[model samples]
Target: MSQLKYKRILLKLSGEALAGEGGYGIDPERVHELAQKIKRVRHLDVQVAVVIGAGNIWRGQIGMRHGMDRATADYMGMLATVINALALQDALEQIGCDTRVQTAIEMKAVAEPYIRRRAIRHLEKGRIVILAAGTGNPYFTTDTAAALRAMEIDAEVLIKATKVDAVYDLDPKVNPNARRYEHLTYLDALNMRVGVMDSTALSLCMDNDLPIVVVDLWGESSIERVVLGDDIGTLISS
Candidate 1:
């Protein structure tokens, strides 16, 4: 009910979030639920771009440890992100929200290739653009891709939807005494090495002065809450 703080946002969702409780592949119910939440933000008239991770299906680095060729493994991971993007696009469209899936690697049969101008145009037209593949390169995580896309799109904020509510001094799951930060500066996170995001992603965000809000995606109305500028999670910024 409050004025929205972000007019345009890039939402970074981990592939594992789409897997839900199944632990593998896309879960239709979970995807639909997430789609509905996104719809709520659309109703708020905010332009949204999504960057989905492929770790639920495969991780290139992990595959390399098993003797798989690094490039081939990374390409496989990229394809996995495409799969997730397509699933999310379909789910969002099923609910009457316009969406597009753009991959860094060309996959004409499934979605459009990454085109910065075109993606921004889509957002301007009120379409949700989902970016797939990790920068179309090996050794880059989707977290980095999200940061890059956020900068390219000039999004007002980056909403990182994770399992946890916010960044903590330590792994909250393992360390019950870990402390949560309500707000953090980029330098603070770097100095402390908080694991909320990877170094590359953190650096990009820091350099760009992009603000980020880390929140639990599974919580009710959490996305809407964050968009409305409510104090619902950890906010990391300049």
Candidate 2:
């Protein structure tokens, strides 16, 4: 077996990804399949921490556009992430992987509140830690949450799993002529306004010198390939 490139990694998964092709809500089969892939990574002895988005259930920005207060909408979005995290925790455990869901907000009955030291201890003990709730505040996207968690956990890289294989000059689905980038620097992505990640998250990653790899989660073994150091997607770094 090839040596894994990353010792510890933070995986950012969108809430919609858990929905699979059905396009809404949690799909059991999809969750199980994702869990199995995660198990593969664990088998390689890599510490995994996941940060999931809540767009599938509720997007605070969208709710705000529809007349909801920004803070209230964001809180709702946080709850949505918690729901996804719990579901993923269950799935991972079903596959025999020890998992923990830590939230930014207090949810004692369901999960542990975000405690940096405790999360680190979990990773040290070989437990997959899933981070939910967007920074425990509003006006922030889960992309930012992933960056924040990656930093908190001292992860080697931020693995952003998306619907697309890589970052493109334009929406590939809408424009066939869109160019995909195999690699990029933080400034390159920022200057180009590449939508691979939010500007805030991108900037944070840049400042911390954390490399990010964006790849399609729907692709076969893409996550494992990435962890194994295969060239599979766009890599953004300083």
Candidate 3:
């Protein structure tokens, strides 16, 4: 067995990552596959916490552009995250992984309210914590929420699971010949205007010197490979 690189990791998954081939809404098989992937990580004896975004169901910026109130759009986006969280929790639990869905907004009937201590305790007890609701405030991206929670939980690294294989100089889809970055510094990602994460989240990670690994979530063993220290994707650090 390969040694685990990060004992505790916070995985940042975009809600669209849960969307399947069509790429517009929750896809059951895809979510279940993601669940099984996390199961593999847990089997590696790595504690995992996930922060899922709400782009699949609702993107506040797009809504606002369509003439919706900014705050209302953001709030709706938060609720969408909670929906994704619950779906993920169900998938994880069905696969026999002990999981908890905690939301920033109080929704006792659906999930436990996010409490820092309780979330940490869940990780300590070998359970997966799915953090939802985007920091419980408007105007904050889930990227920021993921960064904040990783810091709060003292996560060894923040693993960003995305559609792309690695970070590139341009949108690889648009530019087939884009140069890929196998390694990057937070400043490089920021100063270069690279979109590894939004500026606020990138700043937070840089401030704390937290390392980040961006991997393709669609890879068969990418999650396990990353936890086992395989050089599979772009690594942003320092």
Task: Please report how far candidate 2 places residue 32 from its true position, in Å.
Answer: 1.0
lDDT tens string, model 1, 15-60?
A: 9888967567789998999899999998999999999988778877
Query: Could you tell me which residue pairs clash in candidate 2?
Result: none
Error of 1 at 72 (Å): 2.2
What does candidate 2 score in Cα RMSD to the true structure? Answer: 1.1
TM-score of candidate 3 relative to the true fold: 0.97
Selected candidate, larger TM-score, 1 vs 3: 3
- Report the CA-based lDDT of candidate 3 relative to the real structure: 0.91
What candidate 2 gets wrong by more than 4 Å, as runs, is none
In order, the Cα lDDT scores of the candidates are 0.91, 0.92, 0.91
Q: List the residue pairs that clash in candidate 3.
A: none
Report the candidate with higher lDDT, 1 versus 2: 2
Error of 1 at 103 (Å): 0.9
Residues forming the 10-long window of minimal summed lDDT in candidate 3: 15-24
TM per candidate comes to 0.96, 0.97, 0.97
lDDT per residue as tens, model 2, 143-170: 9999988998899999999999999999
